[model samples]
Target: MEATRLEPRTLVNGDMVAIVSPASWPEESVPAWIARQVESWGLHAVIAPHTLDRRGYLAGSDADRAADLNQAIRDPEIRAVIASVGGCGSFRLVPDVDVDALRADPKMLVGYSDITALHQVWNAAGVPTLHGAIAGAHGDHVRRLLMEDADTVVEADRGALSAELTTSGSVEGRLFGGNLEMLARSVGVVDFDVAGGILLLEINRAAGLGMVDRALTQLRYSGALDGVVGVALGSIDQFAGYEDRGWTIVDTLRDHFDALGVPVLGGLPLGHIEDLVTVPLGTAAVLDVDHGRLTVDSPSGD
Candidate 1:
């Protein structure tokens, strides 16, 4: 299979970044704090006109959300797009986006959780995106990716690599994955290929071992697990009702993934965890399990 490489564009200081709430709009009380943080980064943060517009659980109407994203992607002045927060409306807006236009004018796109839908769209369109921190997670490790050079590797504490496997080999490929549940939902429809690629996954809320097993089963059934070079499991924030369950998430996953004969590393600081590191979605990265690290290389020269 041919590799799809998306070059990283340089972000100039003082550029305008459009902030859109594709998911549920954050509570109005938090926007000011978020806005101040963005301003401190030396960039003028432009909030989407409908960012605060709410419709029940959604940040705004489907059209409104889609329009904001579209406008941001097409506007050259907006060097990057950062999601305000992730809730539940991004998937609804995906179908209405002009994927072709986004492909033609590739730019930085950042978010996690519900923003996984946009990550899928950008990946399919051959554009790289950031699947790390967003507005709320600005102070997290994701800030390192945003401000540092592409080749920089931000180190996390040993505790960050919670679950450890015994593989030392390295594999490099376009990063493609997000919240496990969201990826599962896009199995049939989204153009995601894990073959020969690093698969990064995370789960939020407390879930039982059975739930994790079921989701992994779906990946296997859909052939999404086939040819995956490495698996990086991010923070499994809250487990729903596993207090009495004998099976730990690590044990359950180890039993399943270890048999697959690939490098598996957990305790990554991504997803719902605080101080999450921003990972470049669709960018080529090298996974070194022995060292308990994932290094993202610049795709500019590829």
Candidate 2:
């Protein structure tokens, strides 16, 4: 039997949202900006105790980061938990997260990039999570996704690097996957439901196209990509002009995706890019490559 899908209640005026640093610490002013943004939506924002703490690349020690996240999860007043920024180290806090507590009291967990780690955990726990940048210019867009009741439509951006690469037709399924590196790393180590979903693929600056090739290959061989019905490609930043042995990033991505042979819609502006859109993962999405559009529905309880 399939586990019933769970959707956290949408945000309302005056609801308190926890600003946390479950990954690497954000810029000194990011949390404050995020707080002001939340207030602009008529919502309250609480900066978690460890949001500003920095211990190396991480926001703080794993225990401290996890404590802040767990507190937000268990708190009745916190209607959402939003990561201030995404750098690295979220995977380290996974073991210490109170996923069960979140399952008992579902609320939104929003962020992208490194926060992909926590998104997978939350989505696996049966609640939906949002993938987007927190402090970027798109905060208003993120606000609407969390606060409004409407579907999200992401049209392929012709200007984006991934725009030229896509498969044929359209397919609908739950939207799964995020930062390619994170998803690849999660395989075997972390368990989640990707079966029968549309995989969302995106990447940031990496050493080379080999990193992209390896991540996709790992997903293919590890059976992690099994049962995925379609693919939605997002920003592949800093890889357009890059070439590894004359193979462009697009060439590398097409090589792997061609084998999956699923409907793939590329250039959705929802990844590690500025002017990003907030998208709900662990929910239904229609990926239409022929029409160059992807429509996403928020997760709803069965």
Candidate 3:
């Protein structure tokens, strides 16, 4: 049986949202800025205690970070939990998250990049999540996704690196995926599966096509991409022009994706670019590759 589609209640004026640093610690100013932004939407913002704590690359000790997240999850007043940033180390806190509580009182988890680890676990718990930045040029759109009742349609970026790689076909499936490296590392670690979903792939600050090659190869050989109906490529920042041994990032992507034989729609303005468009995971979506469009059902609660 298909898992029932579960959504958190949509945000409303006076609702509380938690800002936590479950991954790497964010800059000190980020919590204040994010709080102001959330308040501007008429929603209250609660900054978790360890949002600014830094223990090297991690936000804090795994125990502290998990405590902050668990506190927010168990709080009946908080309706949404958003990450301050995704520098690194969210994966370690996954096993410690209060998944049972979150499943009982469903709330959206929002962030991307390293936060993809949290997204994986939260999504596996049968809750929809937003793959987006907490604060950026795209914050307004992110607000709409959390607070509004409308479908989101993302058109392909004609000039993006993956734009020319689109294959012809259309598919419908639940959206599933995030940062390519995180997805690769998740194999055998996180129980989240990509089978029967439209896989999303994006990259930022990667070390050329070899890293991309190895990640994709790992997922492919591990049988993670087995029943994926289609793929949507987001920004591959700084790698559009990168060439290694005369092979570009696009060359490496095509070699692996071509083997999957699913319709691929590339260059959608999603992921870690300056003008990012937030997207939801674990929600139903229509991938129309021929028309260069992705129509996704709003994950906002009714």
Clash pairs for candidate 2: none
RMSD of 3: 1.4
Ranked by TM-score, the better of candidates 1 and 2 is 2
| Leading candidate by lDDT | 3
TM-score of each: 0.88, 0.96, 0.96
- Model 2 residue 123 lDDT? 70
Query: Tell me, what's the RMSD of every candidate?
Result: 2.8, 1.7, 1.4
Give lDDT tens digits, candidate 2, residues 64-124.
8989999999999998889998889998887888877888888888888888988879877
Selected candidate, larger lDDT, 2 vs 3: 3
TM-score of 3: 0.96
On the 0 to 100 scale, the lDDT of residue 146 in model 2 is 81
Q: For model 1, what is the C-alpha lDDT against the true structure?
A: 0.73
Q: Model 1: runs farther than 4 Å from truth?
A: 134-144, 152-157, 164-168, 240-245, 299-302
Find the candidate with the highest TM-score and give its number. Answer: 3
lDDT of 1 by residue, 1-302 (tens): 13654554666568777888888998886656656776777768888899899899998789888999999988878877888888798888778878777767677788899899888888888777788664444464444455544553534345543454335676777678898777777777677666788888878754566767777788878887788888777776465334435766656677877767788666667788767777777777777776777877643331
Query: lDDT values of the candidates?
Result: 0.73, 0.84, 0.86
lDDT for position 17 in model 1: 79
Candidate 3 residue pairs in clash (backbone atoms < 3 Å): none
**Model with the higher lDDT, candidate 1 or 2:** 2
